[model samples]
Target chain A: MSTQWIAVIGTCAFAFILKFVGHSLPEKWLAHPRIGRINALIPIVLLTALVTINSVTVKTKIVIDHRMAGLGVAIIALYFKLPFPVIVLGAAVGSAIAYHFSH
Target chain B: MSVKRDSFSLSFAVGAYGTAFGAASATAHFSILQTCLLSLLTFSGASQFAVIGVVGAGGSALSAIATASLLGTRNALYGIRMAPILKVKGFKRIVAAQLTIDESTAIATAQDNEKDQITGFWHTGFGVFIFWNIFTLLGALGAQAIGNPSAWGLDAAVPAAFIALVWPRLVDKKTRLIAVGAIALSLVLVPFTPAGLPIITTSLLAIVVGWRA
Candidate 1:
Protein backbone atom coordinates (compact mmCIF):
# COMPACT_ATOMS: atom_id res chain seq x y z
CA MET A 1 0.00 0.00 0.00
CA SER A 2 2.96 2.29 0.81
CA THR A 3 5.97 3.20 -1.26
CA GLN A 4 8.26 1.05 0.87
CA TRP A 5 6.00 -1.95 0.47
CA ILE A 6 5.77 -1.39 -3.27
CA ALA A 7 9.52 -1.16 -3.50
CA VAL A 8 9.81 -4.35 -1.49
CA ILE A 9 7.59 -6.22 -3.94
CA GLY A 10 9.51 -4.80 -6.86
CA THR A 11 12.75 -5.95 -5.28
CA CYS A 12 11.29 -9.40 -4.83
CA ALA A 13 10.24 -9.50 -8.47
CA PHE A 14 13.70 -8.46 -9.61
CA ALA A 15 15.25 -11.54 -8.08
CA PHE A 16 12.80 -13.70 -9.98
CA ILE A 17 13.39 -11.77 -13.17
CA LEU A 18 17.14 -12.05 -12.97
CA LYS A 19 16.85 -15.70 -12.12
CA PHE A 20 14.44 -16.34 -14.93
CA VAL A 21 16.87 -14.65 -17.25
CA GLY A 22 19.60 -16.88 -15.96
CA HIS A 23 17.42 -19.90 -16.50
CA SER A 24 16.53 -18.72 -19.95
CA LEU A 25 20.11 -18.00 -20.97
CA PRO A 26 21.90 -20.80 -22.71
CA GLU A 27 24.62 -22.62 -20.84
CA LYS A 28 27.16 -21.13 -23.21
CA TRP A 29 26.17 -17.66 -22.09
CA LEU A 30 26.17 -18.59 -18.45
CA ALA A 31 29.41 -20.50 -18.84
CA HIS A 32 31.41 -17.49 -19.86
CA PRO A 33 34.47 -17.56 -17.67
CA ARG A 34 34.18 -13.88 -16.96
CA ILE A 35 30.68 -14.28 -15.65
CA GLY A 36 31.67 -17.16 -13.40
CA ARG A 37 34.71 -15.33 -12.13
CA ILE A 38 32.78 -12.15 -11.48
CA ASN A 39 30.04 -14.07 -9.73
CA ALA A 40 32.54 -15.65 -7.39
CA LEU A 41 34.03 -12.30 -6.57
CA ILE A 42 30.64 -10.65 -6.09
CA PRO A 43 30.03 -12.16 -2.68
CA ILE A 44 33.57 -11.53 -1.53
CA VAL A 45 33.38 -7.91 -2.55
CA LEU A 46 29.89 -7.32 -1.19
CA LEU A 47 30.69 -8.86 2.17
CA THR A 48 33.74 -6.63 2.56
CA ALA A 49 31.74 -3.58 1.65
CA LEU A 50 29.05 -4.57 4.12
CA VAL A 51 31.55 -5.13 6.90
CA THR A 52 33.04 -1.70 6.32
CA ILE A 53 29.73 0.14 6.16
CA ASN A 54 28.35 -1.67 9.18
CA SER A 55 31.45 -1.22 11.28
CA VAL A 56 32.77 2.20 10.37
CA THR A 57 30.01 4.41 9.00
CA VAL A 58 26.71 5.20 10.62
CA LYS A 59 24.52 7.00 8.11
CA THR A 60 27.05 9.36 6.45
CA LYS A 61 29.65 9.76 9.20
CA ILE A 62 32.65 7.67 10.13
CA VAL A 63 32.78 6.98 13.84
CA ILE A 64 34.53 4.33 15.87
CA ASP A 65 32.80 2.67 18.75
CA HIS A 66 32.30 -0.53 20.76
CA ARG A 67 31.46 -2.42 17.56
CA MET A 68 35.14 -2.26 16.66
CA ALA A 69 36.01 -3.71 20.03
CA GLY A 70 33.58 -6.50 19.35
CA LEU A 71 35.14 -6.89 15.92
CA GLY A 72 38.54 -7.16 17.58
CA VAL A 73 37.24 -9.90 19.83
CA ALA A 74 35.59 -11.51 16.81
CA ILE A 75 38.79 -11.55 14.79
CA ILE A 76 40.42 -13.37 17.65
CA ALA A 77 37.51 -15.74 17.95
CA LEU A 78 37.53 -16.32 14.21
CA TYR A 79 41.27 -17.00 14.23
CA PHE A 80 40.66 -19.74 16.75
CA LYS A 81 37.83 -21.03 14.50
CA LEU A 82 34.94 -20.70 16.89
CA PRO A 83 31.56 -21.89 15.62
CA PHE A 84 29.12 -19.54 13.92
CA PRO A 85 26.66 -18.93 16.76
CA VAL A 86 29.48 -18.50 19.20
CA ILE A 87 31.15 -16.01 16.95
CA VAL A 88 27.97 -14.06 16.15
CA LEU A 89 26.42 -13.91 19.61
CA GLY A 90 29.88 -13.68 21.09
CA ALA A 91 30.56 -10.58 19.06
CA ALA A 92 27.23 -9.14 20.19
CA VAL A 93 27.89 -9.93 23.83
CA GLY A 94 31.38 -8.59 23.46
CA SER A 95 30.06 -5.37 21.91
CA ALA A 96 27.34 -4.97 24.50
CA ILE A 97 29.86 -5.39 27.30
CA ALA A 98 32.27 -2.92 25.76
CA TYR A 99 29.47 -0.44 25.09
CA HIS A 100 28.32 -0.75 28.69
CA PHE A 101 31.80 -0.13 30.04
CA SER A 102 32.58 2.69 27.65
CA HIS A 103 29.35 4.59 28.32
CA MET B 1 28.08 -35.08 8.94
CA SER B 2 25.71 -36.36 6.34
CA VAL B 3 24.61 -33.92 3.69
CA LYS B 4 21.03 -33.89 4.93
CA ARG B 5 22.15 -33.34 8.48
CA ASP B 6 24.52 -30.64 7.34
CA SER B 7 21.77 -28.99 5.34
CA PHE B 8 19.29 -29.04 8.20
CA SER B 9 21.69 -27.76 10.82
CA LEU B 10 23.11 -25.06 8.61
CA SER B 11 19.64 -23.86 7.74
CA PHE B 12 18.48 -23.86 11.34
CA ALA B 13 21.47 -21.93 12.62
CA VAL B 14 21.51 -19.33 9.87
CA GLY B 15 17.75 -19.10 9.82
CA ALA B 16 17.66 -18.39 13.54
CA TYR B 17 19.84 -15.39 12.81
CA GLY B 18 16.71 -13.92 11.23
CA THR B 19 16.03 -12.88 14.76
CA ALA B 20 18.72 -10.26 14.26
CA PHE B 21 17.00 -9.00 11.14
CA GLY B 22 13.70 -8.84 12.98
CA ALA B 23 15.36 -6.95 15.79
CA ALA B 24 17.27 -4.70 13.40
CA SER B 25 14.16 -3.95 11.38
CA ALA B 26 12.35 -3.05 14.58
CA THR B 27 15.19 -0.73 15.50
CA ALA B 28 14.84 0.81 12.05
CA HIS B 29 11.16 1.69 12.64
CA PHE B 30 9.53 -1.20 10.80
CA SER B 31 6.28 -2.52 12.25
CA ILE B 32 5.88 -6.14 13.29
CA LEU B 33 3.75 -6.73 10.18
CA GLN B 34 6.15 -5.02 7.79
CA THR B 35 9.10 -6.85 9.31
CA CYS B 36 7.54 -10.28 8.90
CA LEU B 37 6.47 -9.40 5.38
CA LEU B 38 10.06 -8.41 4.63
CA SER B 39 11.33 -11.80 5.67
CA LEU B 40 8.56 -13.56 3.79
CA LEU B 41 8.81 -11.68 0.53
CA THR B 42 12.33 -10.32 0.10
CA PHE B 43 13.83 -13.45 1.73
CA SER B 44 17.42 -12.44 1.28
CA GLY B 45 19.25 -11.57 4.47
CA ALA B 46 21.87 -9.11 3.24
CA SER B 47 19.47 -7.31 0.92
CA GLN B 48 16.82 -7.08 3.61
CA PHE B 49 19.39 -5.67 5.95
CA ALA B 50 20.33 -3.12 3.31
CA VAL B 51 16.67 -2.07 3.02
CA ILE B 52 16.33 -1.34 6.71
CA GLY B 53 19.77 0.23 6.87
CA VAL B 54 18.92 2.62 4.07
CA VAL B 55 15.40 3.47 5.24
CA GLY B 56 16.46 3.79 8.86
CA ALA B 57 19.03 6.44 7.97
CA GLY B 58 16.48 8.84 6.45
CA GLY B 59 17.25 7.65 2.96
CA SER B 60 14.65 7.74 0.21
CA ALA B 61 12.59 4.71 -0.61
CA LEU B 62 14.31 4.68 -4.00
CA SER B 63 17.70 4.40 -2.33
CA ALA B 64 16.51 1.51 -0.20
CA ILE B 65 15.18 -0.26 -3.27
CA ALA B 66 18.34 0.40 -5.22
CA THR B 67 20.62 -0.95 -2.55
CA ALA B 68 18.48 -4.00 -1.94
CA SER B 69 18.03 -4.74 -5.63
CA LEU B 70 21.77 -4.54 -6.19
CA LEU B 71 22.53 -7.04 -3.46
CA GLY B 72 19.79 -9.38 -4.60
CA THR B 73 21.53 -9.74 -7.94
CA ARG B 74 23.80 -12.32 -6.38
CA ASN B 75 20.83 -14.55 -5.86
CA ALA B 76 20.27 -14.47 -9.59
CA LEU B 77 23.81 -15.65 -10.10
CA TYR B 78 23.14 -18.44 -7.66
CA GLY B 79 20.03 -19.27 -9.61
CA ILE B 80 22.01 -19.66 -12.80
CA ARG B 81 24.49 -22.00 -11.20
CA MET B 82 21.80 -24.19 -9.70
CA ALA B 83 19.22 -24.15 -12.50
CA PRO B 84 20.60 -27.02 -14.57
CA ILE B 85 21.15 -29.02 -11.46
CA LEU B 86 17.59 -28.38 -10.36
CA LYS B 87 16.02 -29.12 -13.81
CA VAL B 88 12.52 -28.23 -12.76
CA LYS B 89 9.77 -26.89 -15.03
CA GLY B 90 6.67 -24.72 -14.56
CA PHE B 91 5.65 -24.35 -10.93
CA LYS B 92 8.66 -26.36 -9.82
CA ARG B 93 10.85 -23.75 -11.48
CA ILE B 94 9.40 -21.18 -9.15
CA VAL B 95 10.30 -23.38 -6.23
CA ALA B 96 13.78 -23.79 -7.62
CA ALA B 97 14.13 -20.05 -7.96
CA GLN B 98 12.97 -19.41 -4.43
CA LEU B 99 15.43 -21.99 -3.14
CA THR B 100 18.24 -20.69 -5.29
CA ILE B 101 20.38 -18.89 -2.75
CA ASP B 102 23.95 -18.86 -1.49
CA GLU B 103 23.62 -21.65 1.06
CA SER B 104 21.55 -23.88 -1.16
CA THR B 105 23.89 -23.35 -4.08
CA ALA B 106 26.89 -24.05 -1.90
CA ILE B 107 25.41 -27.17 -0.42
CA ALA B 108 24.16 -28.39 -3.77
CA THR B 109 27.52 -27.84 -5.40
CA ALA B 110 29.19 -29.83 -2.67
CA GLN B 111 27.49 -32.97 -3.85
CA ASP B 112 29.14 -35.10 -6.54
CA ASN B 113 26.03 -36.20 -8.40
CA GLU B 114 22.87 -34.65 -9.81
CA LYS B 115 20.57 -36.51 -7.46
CA ASP B 116 22.49 -35.50 -4.37
CA GLN B 117 22.83 -31.94 -5.62
CA ILE B 118 19.07 -31.64 -6.08
CA THR B 119 18.57 -33.18 -2.68
CA GLY B 120 21.02 -30.77 -1.11
CA PHE B 121 19.48 -27.74 -2.72
CA TRP B 122 15.88 -28.57 -1.80
CA HIS B 123 16.67 -29.56 1.77
CA THR B 124 18.79 -26.51 2.52
CA GLY B 125 16.60 -24.01 0.74
CA PHE B 126 13.26 -25.07 2.10
CA GLY B 127 14.78 -25.71 5.49
CA VAL B 128 16.15 -22.21 5.67
CA PHE B 129 12.98 -20.67 4.27
CA ILE B 130 10.73 -22.34 6.80
CA PHE B 131 12.94 -21.72 9.79
CA TRP B 132 13.86 -18.17 8.83
CA ASN B 133 10.22 -17.09 8.61
CA ILE B 134 9.28 -18.69 11.88
CA PHE B 135 12.15 -17.10 13.79
CA THR B 136 11.46 -13.77 12.14
CA LEU B 137 7.96 -13.78 13.57
CA LEU B 138 9.22 -14.67 17.02
CA GLY B 139 11.92 -12.06 16.84
CA ALA B 140 9.61 -9.23 15.77
CA LEU B 141 7.23 -9.99 18.57
CA GLY B 142 10.11 -10.14 21.01
CA ALA B 143 11.69 -6.91 19.83
CA GLN B 144 8.35 -5.12 20.26
CA ALA B 145 7.92 -6.54 23.73
CA ILE B 146 11.41 -5.49 24.71
CA GLY B 147 10.63 -1.79 24.08
CA ASN B 148 13.83 0.05 23.09
CA PRO B 149 16.17 -2.23 21.15
CA SER B 150 19.11 0.16 21.29
CA ALA B 151 19.45 0.21 25.11
CA TRP B 152 19.95 -3.56 24.94
CA GLY B 153 22.65 -2.92 22.35
CA LEU B 154 20.78 -4.74 19.59
CA ASP B 155 22.18 -2.08 17.29
CA ALA B 156 25.68 -3.46 17.67
CA ALA B 157 24.49 -6.97 16.98
CA VAL B 158 24.15 -6.15 13.28
CA PRO B 159 27.74 -5.17 12.63
CA ALA B 160 29.00 -7.85 14.97
CA ALA B 161 26.89 -10.41 13.16
CA PHE B 162 28.17 -9.10 9.86
CA ILE B 163 31.76 -9.44 11.01
CA ALA B 164 31.06 -12.98 12.09
CA LEU B 165 29.51 -13.77 8.71
CA VAL B 166 32.30 -12.27 6.61
CA TRP B 167 35.32 -13.45 8.60
CA PRO B 168 34.89 -17.09 7.76
CA ARG B 169 34.47 -16.47 4.03
CA LEU B 170 37.87 -14.81 3.68
CA VAL B 171 39.57 -18.09 2.98
CA ASP B 172 42.78 -17.09 1.24
CA LYS B 173 45.23 -14.27 0.62
CA LYS B 174 43.41 -13.03 -2.47
CA THR B 175 40.03 -12.78 -0.77
CA ARG B 176 41.71 -11.29 2.28
CA LEU B 177 43.34 -8.63 0.12
CA ILE B 178 40.06 -7.83 -1.59
CA ALA B 179 38.37 -7.59 1.81
CA VAL B 180 41.00 -5.23 3.14
CA GLY B 181 41.09 -3.16 -0.04
CA ALA B 182 37.29 -2.90 -0.24
CA ILE B 183 37.12 -1.83 3.39
CA ALA B 184 39.72 0.91 2.93
CA LEU B 185 38.18 2.09 -0.31
CA SER B 186 34.70 2.27 1.21
CA LEU B 187 35.96 4.13 4.24
CA VAL B 188 37.62 6.68 2.02
CA LEU B 189 34.53 7.05 -0.12
CA VAL B 190 31.96 7.13 2.66
CA PRO B 191 32.12 10.85 3.42
CA PHE B 192 32.22 11.94 -0.20
CA THR B 193 29.72 9.52 -1.72
CA PRO B 194 26.06 8.84 -1.15
CA ALA B 195 25.04 6.17 1.33
CA GLY B 196 24.43 3.34 -1.16
CA LEU B 197 26.90 4.28 -3.90
CA PRO B 198 30.05 3.08 -2.19
CA ILE B 199 28.81 -0.49 -2.14
CA ILE B 200 28.29 -0.55 -5.91
CA THR B 201 31.73 0.99 -6.35
CA THR B 202 33.35 -1.81 -4.36
CA SER B 203 32.29 -4.22 -7.11
CA LEU B 204 34.83 -2.49 -9.33
CA LEU B 205 37.53 -3.94 -7.14
CA ALA B 206 35.90 -7.33 -7.52
CA ILE B 207 35.80 -6.91 -11.26
CA VAL B 208 39.49 -6.11 -11.42
CA VAL B 209 40.45 -8.97 -9.15
CA GLY B 210 38.16 -11.39 -10.89
CA TRP B 211 39.41 -10.29 -14.30
CA ARG B 212 42.96 -10.92 -13.26
CA ALA B 213 42.08 -14.30 -11.79
Candidate 2:
Protein backbone atom coordinates (compact mmCIF):
# COMPACT_ATOMS: atom_id res chain seq x y z
CA MET A 1 0.00 0.00 0.00
CA SER A 2 1.09 3.57 -0.65
CA THR A 3 2.00 6.03 2.08
CA GLN A 4 -1.09 8.15 1.46
CA TRP A 5 -3.44 5.22 1.91
CA ILE A 6 -1.56 4.10 4.98
CA ALA A 7 -1.72 7.56 6.43
CA VAL A 8 -5.44 7.74 5.81
CA ILE A 9 -6.08 4.41 7.44
CA GLY A 10 -3.83 5.27 10.36
CA THR A 11 -5.57 8.55 10.90
CA CYS A 12 -8.97 6.91 10.72
CA ALA A 13 -7.92 4.29 13.22
CA PHE A 14 -6.56 6.91 15.56
CA ALA A 15 -9.83 8.80 15.33
CA PHE A 16 -11.83 5.70 16.21
CA ILE A 17 -9.72 5.06 19.26
CA LEU A 18 -10.26 8.60 20.43
CA LYS A 19 -14.03 8.46 20.05
CA PHE A 20 -14.42 5.14 21.74
CA VAL A 21 -12.28 6.14 24.67
CA GLY A 22 -13.84 9.55 24.90
CA HIS A 23 -17.45 8.51 24.89
CA SER A 24 -17.26 5.22 26.73
CA LEU A 25 -15.87 6.18 30.11
CA PRO A 26 -18.32 5.93 33.00
CA GLU A 27 -20.08 9.13 34.10
CA LYS A 28 -19.27 8.40 37.72
CA TRP A 29 -15.59 8.31 36.92
CA LEU A 30 -15.81 11.47 34.84
CA ALA A 31 -17.98 13.37 37.31
CA HIS A 32 -15.55 13.06 40.18
CA PRO A 33 -15.01 16.52 41.60
CA ARG A 34 -11.33 16.54 40.77
CA ILE A 35 -11.98 15.26 37.31
CA GLY A 36 -14.82 17.72 36.78
CA ARG A 37 -12.61 20.61 37.71
CA ILE A 38 -9.98 19.43 35.28
CA ASN A 39 -12.54 18.85 32.52
CA ALA A 40 -14.07 22.28 33.05
CA LEU A 41 -10.73 23.77 32.14
CA ILE A 42 -10.23 21.56 29.08
CA PRO A 43 -12.65 23.49 26.90
CA ILE A 44 -10.99 26.81 27.70
CA VAL A 45 -7.52 25.52 26.96
CA LEU A 46 -8.55 23.56 23.91
CA LEU A 47 -10.54 26.44 22.53
CA THR A 48 -7.61 28.75 23.12
CA ALA A 49 -5.27 26.44 21.22
CA LEU A 50 -7.79 25.85 18.46
CA VAL A 51 -8.54 29.55 18.07
CA THR A 52 -4.93 30.72 18.16
CA ILE A 53 -3.90 28.13 15.61
CA ASN A 54 -6.85 28.87 13.35
CA SER A 55 -6.92 32.67 13.61
CA VAL A 56 -3.35 33.91 13.98
CA THR A 57 -1.11 34.54 10.97
CA VAL A 58 2.46 34.62 12.13
CA LYS A 59 4.44 34.69 8.92
CA THR A 60 6.85 37.62 8.54
CA LYS A 61 4.14 39.98 9.85
CA ILE A 62 2.05 40.44 12.97
CA VAL A 63 -1.06 41.80 11.37
CA ILE A 64 -4.40 40.94 13.01
CA ASP A 65 -6.10 40.95 9.60
CA HIS A 66 -9.45 39.33 8.75
CA ARG A 67 -9.32 36.39 11.12
CA MET A 68 -8.80 38.73 14.02
CA ALA A 69 -11.74 40.77 12.87
CA GLY A 70 -13.89 37.67 12.91
CA LEU A 71 -12.51 36.83 16.31
CA GLY A 72 -13.22 40.33 17.47
CA VAL A 73 -16.81 40.02 16.38
CA ALA A 74 -17.04 36.69 18.12
CA ILE A 75 -15.65 38.23 21.29
CA ILE A 76 -18.18 41.03 21.12
CA ALA A 77 -21.01 38.59 20.61
CA LEU A 78 -19.90 36.55 23.58
CA TYR A 79 -19.52 39.66 25.70
CA PHE A 80 -23.04 40.72 24.84
CA LYS A 81 -24.28 37.18 25.50
CA LEU A 82 -25.53 36.78 21.98
CA PRO A 83 -26.94 33.50 20.79
CA PHE A 84 -24.84 31.08 18.74
CA PRO A 85 -26.17 32.13 15.36
CA VAL A 86 -25.70 35.77 16.18
CA ILE A 87 -22.13 35.12 17.15
CA VAL A 88 -21.54 33.28 13.92
CA LEU A 89 -23.18 35.95 11.80
CA GLY A 90 -21.29 38.71 13.54
CA ALA A 91 -17.99 36.98 12.93
CA ALA A 92 -18.86 36.19 9.33
CA VAL A 93 -19.77 39.77 8.63
CA GLY A 94 -16.72 41.00 10.44
CA SER A 95 -14.45 38.64 8.50
CA ALA A 96 -16.01 39.51 5.15
CA ILE A 97 -15.49 43.18 5.86
CA ALA A 98 -11.98 42.69 7.12
CA TYR A 99 -10.99 40.67 4.07
CA HIS A 100 -12.55 43.24 1.76
CA PHE A 101 -10.72 46.16 3.36
CA SER A 102 -7.38 44.47 3.99
CA HIS A 103 -7.07 42.90 0.58
CA MET B 1 -37.80 30.84 12.57
CA SER B 2 -34.97 30.03 14.90
CA VAL B 3 -34.46 26.52 13.53
CA LYS B 4 -34.74 27.68 9.94
CA ARG B 5 -32.39 30.51 10.59
CA ASP B 6 -29.88 28.24 12.25
CA SER B 7 -30.01 25.68 9.46
CA PHE B 8 -29.77 28.24 6.69
CA SER B 9 -26.98 30.16 8.31
CA LEU B 10 -24.93 27.07 9.08
CA SER B 11 -25.47 25.59 5.63
CA PHE B 12 -24.60 28.78 3.83
CA ALA B 13 -21.64 29.50 6.02
CA VAL B 14 -20.23 25.99 6.01
CA GLY B 15 -21.15 25.41 2.38
CA ALA B 16 -19.17 28.43 1.27
CA TYR B 17 -15.94 26.94 2.56
CA GLY B 18 -16.94 23.45 1.54
CA THR B 19 -17.34 24.71 -2.00
CA ALA B 20 -13.90 26.22 -1.87
CA PHE B 21 -12.35 22.96 -0.73
CA GLY B 22 -14.10 21.11 -3.53
CA ALA B 23 -12.94 23.55 -6.16
CA ALA B 24 -9.39 23.49 -4.87
CA SER B 25 -9.33 19.73 -4.84
CA ALA B 26 -10.65 19.67 -8.38
CA THR B 27 -8.00 22.10 -9.50
CA ALA B 28 -5.43 19.88 -7.85
CA HIS B 29 -6.67 16.93 -9.95
CA PHE B 30 -8.34 15.11 -7.08
CA SER B 31 -11.27 13.06 -8.28
CA ILE B 32 -14.72 13.83 -6.93
CA LEU B 33 -14.56 10.48 -5.18
CA GLN B 34 -11.27 11.37 -3.55
CA THR B 35 -12.51 14.76 -2.43
CA CYS B 36 -15.70 13.30 -1.05
CA LEU B 37 -13.78 10.60 0.72
CA LEU B 38 -11.45 13.11 2.29
CA SER B 39 -14.33 15.19 3.55
CA LEU B 40 -16.25 12.22 4.81
CA LEU B 41 -13.29 10.42 6.30
CA THR B 42 -10.92 13.09 7.52
CA PHE B 43 -13.55 15.77 7.91
CA SER B 44 -11.02 18.35 8.98
CA GLY B 45 -10.65 21.56 7.01
CA ALA B 46 -7.30 22.81 8.27
CA SER B 47 -5.67 19.41 8.07
CA GLN B 48 -7.15 18.79 4.65
CA PHE B 49 -5.86 22.15 3.45
CA ALA B 50 -2.48 21.47 4.97
CA VAL B 51 -2.26 18.11 3.21
CA ILE B 52 -3.26 19.60 -0.11
CA GLY B 53 -0.97 22.58 0.34
CA VAL B 54 2.02 20.33 0.97
CA VAL B 55 1.16 18.23 -2.03
CA GLY B 56 0.70 21.33 -4.17
CA ALA B 57 4.04 22.61 -2.95
CA GLY B 58 5.59 19.32 -4.11
CA GLY B 59 6.24 18.07 -0.63
CA SER B 60 6.28 14.32 -0.07
CA ALA B 61 3.12 12.51 0.94
CA LEU B 62 4.84 11.64 4.21
CA SER B 63 5.46 15.28 4.92
CA ALA B 64 1.87 16.10 4.13
CA ILE B 65 0.65 13.34 6.42
CA ALA B 66 2.92 14.51 9.22
CA THR B 67 1.66 18.05 8.93
CA ALA B 68 -1.93 16.90 8.88
CA SER B 69 -1.35 14.64 11.84
CA LEU B 70 0.15 17.46 13.86
CA LEU B 71 -2.94 19.56 13.36
CA GLY B 72 -5.21 16.59 14.02
CA THR B 73 -3.66 15.90 17.40
CA ARG B 74 -6.11 18.35 18.90
CA ASN B 75 -8.92 15.86 18.32
CA ALA B 76 -7.27 13.51 20.74
CA LEU B 77 -7.61 16.09 23.46
CA TYR B 78 -11.27 16.46 22.52
CA GLY B 79 -11.64 12.72 22.82
CA ILE B 80 -10.15 12.74 26.28
CA ARG B 81 -12.82 15.14 27.42
CA MET B 82 -15.71 13.35 25.73
CA ALA B 83 -14.70 9.85 26.77
CA PRO B 84 -17.27 9.65 29.50
CA ILE B 85 -20.16 11.06 27.54
CA LEU B 86 -19.98 8.58 24.67
CA LYS B 87 -21.28 5.27 26.02
CA VAL B 88 -20.17 3.03 23.23
CA LYS B 89 -18.01 0.04 24.02
CA GLY B 90 -15.93 -2.46 22.05
CA PHE B 91 -16.17 -1.96 18.27
CA LYS B 92 -18.63 0.87 18.57
CA ARG B 93 -15.92 3.11 19.99
CA ILE B 94 -14.19 2.97 16.61
CA VAL B 95 -17.31 4.09 14.82
CA ALA B 96 -17.78 6.96 17.27
CA ALA B 97 -14.21 8.13 16.68
CA GLN B 98 -14.81 8.36 12.95
CA LEU B 99 -17.72 10.69 13.68
CA THR B 100 -15.96 12.99 16.10
CA ILE B 101 -14.80 16.32 14.63
CA ASP B 102 -14.51 19.92 15.69
CA GLU B 103 -18.20 20.74 15.49
CA SER B 104 -19.57 17.63 17.17
CA THR B 105 -16.90 17.63 19.81
CA ALA B 106 -17.41 21.30 20.55
CA ILE B 107 -21.18 21.01 20.71
CA ALA B 108 -20.97 17.91 22.86
CA THR B 109 -18.58 19.47 25.33
CA ALA B 110 -20.30 22.83 25.56
CA GLN B 111 -23.72 21.72 26.70
CA ASP B 112 -24.52 21.95 30.41
CA ASN B 113 -26.70 18.88 30.56
CA GLU B 114 -26.01 15.24 29.68
CA LYS B 115 -29.02 14.78 27.41
CA ASP B 116 -28.13 17.95 25.60
CA GLN B 117 -24.58 16.79 25.12
CA ILE B 118 -25.69 13.55 23.50
CA THR B 119 -28.17 15.27 21.28
CA GLY B 120 -25.65 17.94 20.38
CA PHE B 121 -22.99 15.39 19.50
CA TRP B 122 -25.23 13.30 17.28
CA HIS B 123 -26.95 16.23 15.65
CA THR B 124 -23.82 18.21 15.01
CA GLY B 125 -21.74 15.27 13.86
CA PHE B 126 -24.39 13.74 11.65
CA GLY B 127 -25.58 17.08 10.35
CA VAL B 128 -22.11 18.31 9.50
CA PHE B 129 -21.11 15.00 7.94
CA ILE B 130 -24.12 14.95 5.64
CA PHE B 131 -23.85 18.59 4.67
CA TRP B 132 -20.11 18.54 4.37
CA ASN B 133 -20.16 15.48 2.12
CA ILE B 134 -22.98 16.78 -0.04
CA PHE B 135 -21.36 20.18 -0.50
CA THR B 136 -17.98 18.61 -1.20
CA LEU B 137 -19.54 16.56 -4.00
CA LEU B 138 -21.28 19.65 -5.29
CA GLY B 139 -18.06 21.61 -5.24
CA ALA B 140 -16.10 18.85 -6.95
CA LEU B 141 -18.69 18.25 -9.65
CA GLY B 142 -19.25 21.96 -10.23
CA ALA B 143 -15.67 23.03 -9.74
CA GLN B 144 -15.42 24.52 -13.20
CA ALA B 145 -18.80 26.20 -12.97
CA ILE B 146 -17.97 27.71 -9.60
CA GLY B 147 -15.20 29.89 -11.05
CA ASN B 148 -12.24 31.07 -8.98
CA PRO B 149 -12.78 30.23 -5.31
CA SER B 150 -10.32 32.92 -4.34
CA ALA B 151 -12.51 35.47 -6.07
CA TRP B 152 -15.27 34.55 -3.65
CA GLY B 153 -12.92 34.89 -0.70
CA LEU B 154 -13.63 31.27 0.17
CA ASP B 155 -10.21 30.89 1.71
CA ALA B 156 -11.35 33.13 4.51
CA ALA B 157 -14.37 31.01 5.29
CA VAL B 158 -12.71 28.38 7.43
CA PRO B 159 -11.05 30.89 9.71
CA ALA B 160 -14.31 32.78 9.86
CA ALA B 161 -16.10 29.60 10.84
CA PHE B 162 -13.46 28.95 13.45
CA ILE B 163 -13.85 32.44 14.80
CA ALA B 164 -17.56 31.86 15.09
CA LEU B 165 -16.92 28.65 16.92
CA VAL B 166 -14.32 30.04 19.31
CA TRP B 167 -15.73 33.48 19.97
CA PRO B 168 -18.76 32.28 21.90
CA ARG B 169 -16.61 30.24 24.25
CA LEU B 170 -14.37 33.01 25.55
CA VAL B 171 -16.63 34.07 28.42
CA ASP B 172 -14.01 34.75 31.07
CA LYS B 173 -10.80 36.60 31.84
CA LYS B 174 -8.57 33.51 31.80
CA THR B 175 -9.83 32.23 28.45
CA ARG B 176 -9.50 35.68 26.93
CA LEU B 177 -5.98 36.04 28.31
CA ILE B 178 -4.96 32.64 27.00
CA ALA B 179 -6.39 33.40 23.58
CA VAL B 180 -4.56 36.73 23.41
CA GLY B 181 -1.33 35.07 24.51
CA ALA B 182 -1.67 32.29 21.96
CA ILE B 183 -2.23 34.73 19.11
CA ALA B 184 0.71 36.86 20.15
CA LEU B 185 2.94 33.82 20.39
CA SER B 186 1.75 32.53 17.00
CA LEU B 187 2.52 35.88 15.35
CA VAL B 188 5.96 35.92 16.92
CA LEU B 189 6.73 32.41 15.67
CA VAL B 190 5.18 32.49 12.18
CA PRO B 191 8.25 33.80 10.38
CA PHE B 192 10.50 31.25 12.04
CA THR B 193 8.37 28.15 11.52
CA PRO B 194 6.04 26.42 9.13
CA ALA B 195 2.33 27.13 8.65
CA GLY B 196 0.77 24.95 11.40
CA LEU B 197 3.61 24.52 13.87
CA PRO B 198 3.04 27.84 15.54
CA ILE B 199 -0.46 26.67 16.44
CA ILE B 200 0.87 23.61 18.18
CA THR B 201 3.39 25.63 20.13
CA THR B 202 0.87 28.26 21.06
CA SER B 203 -1.60 25.59 22.13
CA LEU B 204 0.99 24.07 24.43
CA LEU B 205 1.67 27.51 25.82
CA ALA B 206 -2.06 28.00 26.39
CA ILE B 207 -2.23 24.66 28.18
CA VAL B 208 0.56 25.79 30.45
CA VAL B 209 -1.15 29.09 31.09
CA GLY B 210 -4.43 27.33 31.79
CA TRP B 211 -2.78 24.86 34.09
CA ARG B 212 -1.01 27.57 35.97
CA ALA B 213 -4.05 29.74 36.27
Name the best candidate (by lDDT).
1
Q: Tens digits of per-residue lDDT for model 2 on A48-89?
A: 444555455433334456757777777777678775446545
Residue B133, model 1, lDDT: 91
In candidate 1, how many Å is residue B14 off? Answer: 2.5
Which ranges in model 2 have alpha carbons more than 4 Å from their true place? A1-13, A23-103, B1-31, B44-93, B100-128, B140-144
Tell me the chain A TM-score of model 1: 0.83
lDDT of 1 at A85: 58
Model-by-model DockQ, in order? 0.53, 0.25
Superposed on the true chain A, the predicted chain A of model 2 yields a TM-score of 0.65
Error of 2 at B42 (Å): 2.9
Total clashes for model 2: 5
